[model samples]
Target chain A: MKQRNEQLPPGIRGFLIRMGQIDRRWIYLAVAVAIAAPMLARLRFPEVPGRMAQATFDAIESIPPGSRVLIAYDFDPASAAELEPMANAVLHHCASKGHRIALMALWPLGKQLADDAIRDILLEYHPEKVEGVDYVQLGFKTGNEGVIKLMSTSIAEAYAADASGKPITQIPLLEGVRTIGDFQLIASISAGTPGAQQWVQYGDSAMPDAFKFVAGTTGVQSSQLLPYYPKQMEGMLIAIKGAAEYEMLVTEKYPVTRSADRLALGRERMGPQFVAHLLLIGLIVLGNVSMLAARGWKGAAR
Target chain B: MSADRAQQSSGAPKSDTRLWIALLIFGAVGIFAGKLWRPGPLAEAYVEVVTETRVLAEVVPAPTTQGTSTDVQSAETVAPTSLEQENAPTTRVWVELDDPRFKSGELRRVEGVATEVWDERAKVDPKKAREQIAALESDAEKLSAPTDPTGLTREEFEAREAARMNALKVVESTRIVASPRDSIGIWIAALLTLGIFSFLVRDNPFYKVVESILIGVSAAYWMLVAFWSTLVPDLFAKLAPDLVRATMLPGLAPSEHPGKDFLLALIPLALGMMLLWRLAPRGAWIAVWPLAVVIGTFAGMRLTASIEADFMAQIAATMKPLVAYTSSSAEGAAAGSAFDLGGTLAGILGVVGVITVLVYFFFSLEHKGVVGKTARVGVWFLMITFGAAFGFTVMGRITLLVGRFDFLFNDWLGLSP
Candidate 1:
C-alpha cells in the first residue's frame, strides 16, 4: 500500500486524501441523483420471487374463498410507503379470491391506514362489496398485545364498535365471529411493536393451527421475525423488495387491468431501489479506497 | 506542539482537480463493468437465473352506478355464490337514511361537564362522597330484588336501558363522511418532509421546527387517545355513573356478560383513582400498591409470553431433521437427492450456528484454543447476520427516501409518471 501511494503522483495522492474528507452534502446529492434518476428514467427490472415472498403469496392463495381474514394494520403513515404497496397487493389478491376482510388496528393511526386501504383497494376495485356484510373495520384498539389477548378470547370484548362507532353486533360479517380463531387467516402488515411479534405471542400461541398467520414488516424488523418464518409465521414479506416480488405473483394470478398502475407500484418502486443499492456499493468502495490511500500516505511520511 | 505543527504541515490534506477526473473515470468504468459482468460457470453452480416478460392488460371499465344502486339486494335475500364470480353480490343491507335509533345527539358534552364537577367534589371531600356512597348502598340493600340497582324504579331503569341500547345501535350504523383533502395539507406535509431531509445537509431551524412539531403532536395524540379509549370509556364512564353514563348512556343496558365487563372495569378504575390520589399529600404512599400490581402483572405476562414465544418456540423450530430424505429408495432418492443434501447441510449449519453464538455470549468459559476458534466462528456468524441486517436497513431507508421523492415529485409537483 505504501509503495502504491508513493508511485502515484502527488496531485492524485492529495486528491484521494481530500476526497476522503469531502463534505457529506456531496454524498447526499449523489444519493438524490441515484434515487431520482431511475424514477425519472422509468427504469424497470425483473424480479425473481424469493422464498419468503413466495410463501406469503401461497399462504393467502391457499385460503378458501369467502373465508374470513383478519388484517391487523399495525402501522402509521410514516411506514405507509414501505408497507402500503404490499398491503395493497395482498388486499387486491384477497378481494379477487372473494375473502371477507376483518380490518383492525393495534396502533392508533393504523385505523386510518386500514381505512385508506379500504378506500384505495376495496372501494376502488371492488365497488359492489358492502361495508359491514363483506368487510368490517374493528378500528384501532389500545392495549397492544392486551387487545390481541382479548380478541383471542372474544373479539367483541376488545372491539365493541367499528372505527366509525358502529357496534360489532350490527356488522353482518362479524355475526358468527367470537374469537380470533374464527378467522381463516390473519395478516399483520406491521412496522414495529405490538405488531407481528405481538400477534405471534398472543394470537398464534393462544390458538395455534386455528388460523394461518402471515406477516409483512419493515426490513429492519425482519431479523426479529426471521426465526419464526415458515414456522410460526407461515409466510413473511420483508420490505419493498418482498413487496415487489409478492406484487408480481399476485398480479400474475389475479390481474387488475385498469388498476395496473396501482398493482405495478411495488415493481415500479424497485427501480430506484436497485439504483440506490448500486450507489451504496460504490460509496463503500470509494470510502475504503480513500482510507487505504490516506494510511499509505501517513506511513510514507513516517 | 512544535513537532505536531511540523507533522501537520508535511502531511496536510489538500483538494486537487485530479480527484474529479479520477472519480468520473472510476464511475464510468464501474457502471460499464456492472452492465457487462457475468458470473463464471463455477458461480453459476450456486446461482439461479429466472426471467419473464409480462404485459399488463388494459381493463374495460364496467358501467357502475353513479349513485347508490336502486337494485340493492338485502343481506337476507342474497344467497352465497360459488367462487367462480367473486364480484357477485353476496350480502347487502338497506341502511335507512333517517334512522331514529341513531339519534344519540350531543348528550356527551353535558355528561363531560357534569363528570368534571363530580370528580372535583370527590377529590375535595372524599369522606363525604364515601359516606354518601355507603348510605346509597345501605338504601339499595334494604330494597327488594327487582326494585333497581340504583335509586331508579325497575320500570324506569328498563325503559332507559332500552333507549340507551337504541341510541348505541343508531350510532353504530352511522356512516361518517370522508374528510376532504386540500393542497394546503399537502404543501405542509411536503415542507415537513423537506425539513426532515434538510438534516442530511446540516442541522437547521427547519429541521428543528419539524422535529418539535412531531414530538408535540405525538405527545398530544397519545394523551387524547388514552383519555377517550381508556380513561373516559373504561374508567370515567363506569365509575362516575350518575354524571356520565346515566346522562349520556342513560343506563348502558348491562352487557350480556355483565359481571365480567363491570368487575373487570372496576379494578382498573379504582387503581386509576388511587394513582390520581397520589397527588394528595396524605396518602401518597398508597400509590405504590397500584404501581406494584401493574408491574407484577406486566412482568408476569411478558415473562411467560417471551419465554414461550421467543425462546421455546424458536428452539422448537430450530430442531429440524439433519437429513431430509426418505428412508428407502422406493420413496424416490434421485429426484430428492439435491434437496435432501441442501436441507441436511442447512440444518446442521443452523444448529452449529446457534450453539456457537450461544458459546460466544458465555463469558464464564474463557475462549482459548478450540473454544477460541469456535468463538471466532460465532463472530463470523454474528457479522454475517449484522451485515444482512444492515443491507436490509439500507434498503428500508432508501425506500423511505424514494417515497419522499415520489411525494415531492409526483403528488406535490404533479410530475407525470
Candidate 2:
C-alpha cells in the first residue's frame, strides 16, 4: 500500500519522501561536503575554552612536578580521532609539568595508542628521559575490572611483569607502588563501555580518597559521566568541544615546543563544525519553507 | 537454532548433530596435536636470586646505627653477633648471608627476631624500656615457640609470609589499571559478537543475551564496588576506630559500636530485600509498598533534574544577545570571544529551533491557525536535527571503519605506519 507513494514528481516527491524516508547515502554525501569543504579551505575558527575542559586542564596542572600519573589509554584505535587530541594534549601537559607517567591500556589496541603517542611525542621529542625510571609502560593485562580490583589490593600480584616480560620489581618507577592509589593522579581517556563511566563507577567510586581521577569521553557518553563529576571525577573532557577547550587551556598555559600542535587540531576542527551547524540550520529552514510552499500553493495549481 | 521451523517446512529436522560431533572431535585432536607439536622459546632467566634469607635483627624506630632494611622479611641469615655489635641499637639491620637455601637447613632457622619496630618515642627511657623489653622478651620468646608447627621452622616462616600475601589478595583486587580484556579471540567470539549485534535486526534469544550482558555487567560492577567501597573503607578502616571510641568515650554522633549499628542497619536492609519477593508468582503484589517509595523518589528526582538540567537551563542559554538586533551596541561586534556575527545568528537560530521543536511535541494542545503552521515548522526542525545527529554519528563510525581499513592496508601491509 505504501509503495503507491513512490510515484510522484521528482522534486516534490523527493521532498515528501525526505519528510518521511529517503536514501541515507544522500545524507552521507551532504555530510561529507559539510566536513570536506571547511577542511579543503583550511578553515580556522576561534574557540572559548569551556569550563569543564578548563577544569580538566587545571586538575592536571595542580599536580606537583615529579608526581606519578597513570594515563589509561582505555579506548581502542576506533576512537582515535575523537579522543587522541585530548590524550596528546594531556601527555604534553603532563610532560610540561615533568610528571612521571606510567602508560597502560585496558583495551588491547589501546597499547598501540600508547605506542603511537610514544613514537610521535615521547621518543622523538623527549629523548633524554629514561624508561623504567622516568616513565614506564606497564603494558596491558587481560582482566577488565578484575585487574582493577587486583591492582587495588596488590599491584605486584596483578602484574608481575611489564609488557616486555620484565618483572615489574625491576622497574624503579613502580617501586613501593602497591595499587592505582599509589599514583598521584589517574586519567582515563576512553570512548564507551570500559571507558570513562567504568573508570568513574568502578575505579574512582571504589576508593574516592585514594587517587584523583579525570576522564576524556565522547559526547554521547559525557552526560553519563556528569553525575560523578567534581565529587567522584575531578574533571571531564567531552568530545570535540571538550577537546578543543582543553587544548586551548593547555596550549595557552604550557605550550609544546614541536610539530603536531594540539590547539590547532581542536580549533581547525571547530571551523568545520561551525560551518556544518550553519548548513544544518539552513537545511531545516529550507525543508520547512518547501513544506509551506507545497501546501499553500497547491490551491493556485488546482 | 530454527530447527522447529525447518522441521515444519521440510517434514524433518536437519541432522546437524553429526556436524557438532565432528567439530568436537576435530578440536580435541587439533589441541592435542598442537600441544605435542609446538616448540618452546630458548631463553635464559633474567633474574637471579641473591640472598635467600636475612635476619631481622634490631629494628629500632630511629637508630642511626642500624643499616637499611632490605628483605629481612625472611629471617635467618644473621651471623651470631658480639655484645658490642648486638647492643649498638640500630633501627633495622638486615644482616647479609650467603644464599641460605643452598647452605645447611640450620641456616634457615633464625627465630624471635622482631620484624616490626613500633616507635622510639614509646621508649622514653631507653634503659628502663630495654629492661622491660628484656623481661617481655623472655616471655615472648617462649610464646614465639611453635606448639606444633605444620613443618620445619623455615617452612613456618615461608607459610607466614605466604599467608600475609594471601590476606593482601583482597586489596589486590581493588586495583585500577589499564588491563586488556581481550577475552575470547576475535574469531572465536562470533557467538557473542553476532548475538549482541542481532538486536539491530529484531528482539529474540540472541538479543536477550546482549540485554542480559548489560545487566550482568552492571551487577558484577556493583558486586566488586560494594566490597571495596562499603566493606573495606567502612568495615576495615573503622574496625579499630569503632571499638576505641565505644570503649573509651561513649555517646558519639553515630554510635561507636559497629556491632550495634550494624544490627540497626539491617532493618532497612531487610526491608530493601523484601522488594525482591515480587519475583515470585504468588505474593508478587506484596512488593508494591516497598517499591512505592523507591519508584516515587526515583520519579521525583528524575523529573526535578531533567526539567532543570535539560529544559529550563537549555532554554535560558538559547536567548540571543541584545546586540544581535541592536546595531548601535559594541556587543554587536564581539560575542563570547568570537566575532558576534556568527554567534548572534547561532543564538537567534537556537532559540527559534528550540521553540519549534517544543511546538512539534505539544500534542495536548489542538493545532489552530498559526499553531498548525508553527507546529509543522517544528517537526521539520526536529527531523533535520535527527538527520544531522545520525549523519554525525555515522561519520564517527565511518572514521572507525576507515581506521580498521588503514590498519589492514597500511599498518599491517606497512604502507602507512
DockQ of each: 0.67, 0.09
DockQ of 2: 0.09
Q: In candidate 1, list every pair of residues with a backbone clash.
A: A166-B172, B102-B170
B121-222 in candidate 1: lDDT tens per residue? 101112223344455455444432343448888888988767656655544333221112334566788789878876664455678799999999999999
Give lDDT tens digits, candidate 1, residues A82-163: 9999989888888889999988888889998888789778877889889988898888887998999999999889988787
Instruction: Please list the residue runs of candidate 1 whose C-alpha ends up more than 4 Å from where it truly belongs after superposition.
Output: A1-14, A150-182, A205-211, A296-302, B1-181, B211-221, B234-239, B244-339
Residue range A124-161, candidate 2, lDDT tens digits: 45677788877888777767767676776777887888
Query: Best candidate per lDDT, number?
Result: 1
Give residue B354's lDDT in candidate 2 (0 to 100). Answer: 80
Quote the lDDT for A229 in model 1: 74
Chain A fold similarity by TM-score, each prediction: 0.92, 0.86
